[model samples]
Target: MLTETGKEYLRYVTEAFDILLLGQQNSRHAAAAPRLMLYTLPSLATKWLLPELHNWRACTPDVDLALHGTHAQFDFNTMHADFVICFGEERYAQLEKKFLFHDEVLPVPSPELIACYQGRKLLSKAPLIHLEWVNERRFLPNWRDWFQAKEIEEPEPQPSFIFNLTLLALHAAVAGAGVILGQRNLIANELASGTLVIVDELSLPHSKPNFLAWPQRTLSQPGSRQPIAWPVELAGTDS
Candidate 1:
């Protein structure tokens, strides 16, 4: 009972709808592919989880990852990163926080420097390498807090170097630049390998546990998968 024109119109509409559905499915699949951008503290990136990140690539072969390291105060609103890894005591109200692990700060120096300071009080005269978080108000970690926790007074001014990145400080310490307050989790390998030596058994309490945080509303997105399992697995394996 339908005219030829009506039949053609119906056929065309059905084909168009099928194409649209197919296109939508393809778009979703493309979006679901494991592409993640992670913003983290520089210390965590260069020192602690660099190797683990390589391993993550191995485990999730389909993933495309971009890592950014900066101060914890980075603007989350402008960041396109899928996730953030940072250390803090309090969770951001706008983000979903997952506790990764706790870190302890230890004093570290090169082997030669340790030998030079052997059998002497650590703070006797040697310069201490300082990693300064210039923007301390934003919850960036610092060496002052660690010293305070141990009830140690700040050393008198001496020849010193200040670095924004923890890795640079670690490298400088390893290169015999100065004594650094190294994170146990970050410096484990260097300590074990004798590249760096712990000057004392003293460790300072960390300001916060390492955590994975993502935008609260974006938690359900497919790209959010990497942050969840990666940190959990890393922490578990570390223990």
Candidate 2:
């Protein structure tokens, strides 16, 4: 029983309200899908895992992610990414740290190289592949430290072929380029498949835990999610 003008006004208001509600609902759905940027050490990338990367894909299927991998020496402060997976406690003052997995490093080489260098002084005669950590603090996984840890004296000459990244060193060892101190987890498939063999049973204490780091402030964000359960499950599973 309303006038035509009144009915027209009512119709307009009803349509506007419906549009606003629809927009609100769509915004909420978009917010539910986390759009994240992650920074990680190149070694992790070489191992085919990135920060919050695998768990996000596995656990939160709705999340959208982008990953950046750099040498473990990357400067976290310079990164515009939302999260970083880095080593050591000295970095990330304002972030929460979630320990992922630990790594044990062993000297590895191609079977051919091992056979060729057999019965020789482990360090002096064999070509040692070296991984140079851009960040010195995180680069202790080398022949010198591993040898020292096993109480083997330092060899006369250091490694002749030094690479800036662990993956490079690993590839070199695989190609029979040299002997590399490698992480068991990263090279497990090769070791299992016999593509690479542990030259020495002596493993160094390069066993440091990998961590997921995010700003503490982001913890309360609507899209923020943590892989607390995933890491616990992954810890028991081999890296």
Candidate 3:
């Protein structure tokens, strides 16, 4: 019904309008997309976070997650983050702290290490591995502390292997390198699977508690205390 010039003009306008609509849609998607960053210890990442991360995807398909596993505390001053699962008792006084759970440590060793020892005096002979962590708190839970918890004398210094991260110590224990004071809750899977077992039945309660924390100023802080639900979902934790 239109002349050639008018038809061409209408076609041009239609294409332009479509392009603008697409741009608007893309902008809305970009704005609506949620991105979260979390920092946690290597052991917790392997034994806890990673196992449960799939649940988040199933629950909320839109969220993009960035996870960092480390031994030392992350510097929030420079790095932008949503949350952190740190080993301590409210060390960040200014930051809003969500209490996760306290750590329960017991001596754990691989089945191979148990087989290597025929005698009943297993604790005295096995290589004693220790996790050397730089905690903000003064109390350092170690092999001596574990023995003290059982009300027994600390064993003589045996050949020792020390590691900075708990995951490394867990690996060492699994490899039959030594017995490590393992976090029972953290290493529950290993314990359940029979790859690792409690060498000493005594589980010493750590002085400090694990916390899911974020800077008070972070605008994205969820009203719920779950802090990404990294801790509460775990069994035997105070919600």
Provide backbone clash counts, one per model: 0, 0, 0
Candidate scoring better on TM-score of 1 and 2: 1
State the weakest 10-residue window (summed lDDT) of model 1: 134-143
- Decreasing lDDT order of the candidates: 3, 1, 2
Candidate whose TM-score is highest: 3
Quote model 3's TM-score.
Answer: 0.77
Per residue, candidate 1 scores C-alpha lDDT tens digits across 16-106 of 9999999999888676675678888777887767868778877777666778887756556885777778677354556777778877777
Clashing pairs in 3: none
Which lDDT tens digits does candidate 3 get at residues 119-183?
54678788899877765324547887767777767778888898877788888888999888888
| Model 3 poorest ten-residue lDDT run | 221-230
TM-score of every model? 0.73, 0.71, 0.77
Q: 73-96, model 2: which lDDT tens digit per residue? A: 444467566677766646765577
Model 3: lDDT of residue 113: 90
Residue 229 of model 1: what lDDT?
82
What is residue 24's positional error in candidate 1, in angstroms?
Answer: 17
